[model samples]
Target: MPVSLTIIPELNLVHIIYSGQVTPKELFEETQACYQRPEYKPGMAEVSDFFQVTSFEIGYDEVHEFTSRSKSTHGGVDIGTDICLVGSTKVSEPAILMYEGMIAAKEIPIRLHVLPGYPEALAVLNLPEDSLKYFPEGCHTERHLL
Candidate 1:
């Protein structure tokens, strides 16, 4: 899969790594799975790595719909942390812009941070630079899929 999601319970963080080309279906599925995790709290911070994604198949409409659908489940009232997006790929920026727009329109309680790397993501979430090691190097994403 091109899109993957990892939820870190100890850190109260969600990590999404997108490699190769991404499809809308895969993105939505992984996202839903991420939120369904027992460790996934509303106020948890997130780091999304899209630098490896060569391209994305979804457009503004799909992005908007995806976000709209996510609203009922993704946000938690106590969501105390900001959502950080780390994407270096060209496709990452436009998607970020579109999603930001959707978030603004919906007035979600989450602060979306669009960055180019995990270092900036950690900084945005006020986490230590070395904290990344705490997260699994493997596919920690699937643990939340069920």
Candidate 2:
């Protein structure tokens, strides 16, 4: 799979890492599957890392539709969650901006941040500085990866 999901329940964080060439179907399917996992919580913060993604095949319609469905699953009158996007200018900026636009248009109350890498994402989420020091290489058993 080009996409992998890692949920760190203790930190109320979920990291979705994408690599190689990715399609809209693969991306959304992995995300929806992640939502169905037992470890997923409604308000948990998300770090969507598109750093290694060489190509992201998505567009306005796909993002809009996903955001619409996502609103039903993650929107309400309560406090919203944070979503940090780890991406690069060439590969993922357009899609990130589109998703941001959708969220804003729908007024879903999700705080989205676009950062360069994992360190920045950790800072935005207010997590420990060293939280992902050994990530994607060596991780604790507590982190459930799918």
> Backbone collision count in every prediction?
2, 0
Clash-forming residue pairs, model 2: none
lDDT of 2 at 34: 90
CA RMSD (A), model 2:
5.0
lDDT of 2 by residue, 1-146 (tens): 78999888878888888888888888888989998999998988888877678888888899998898779767962788899887665877788889898999999868988876676777788887567753666333333321
Error of 1 at 61 (Å): 1.8
Q: Write the per-residue lDDT of candidate 1 for residues 66-144, one digit (tens) a residue.
A: 8787576555565445778865567777887888889888876668887756666666777775676765555233333
- lDDT of prediction 1: 0.73
Q: What would the TM-scores of all predictions be?
A: 0.84, 0.87
Maximum-lDDT candidate: 2
CA lDDT for candidate 2: 0.80
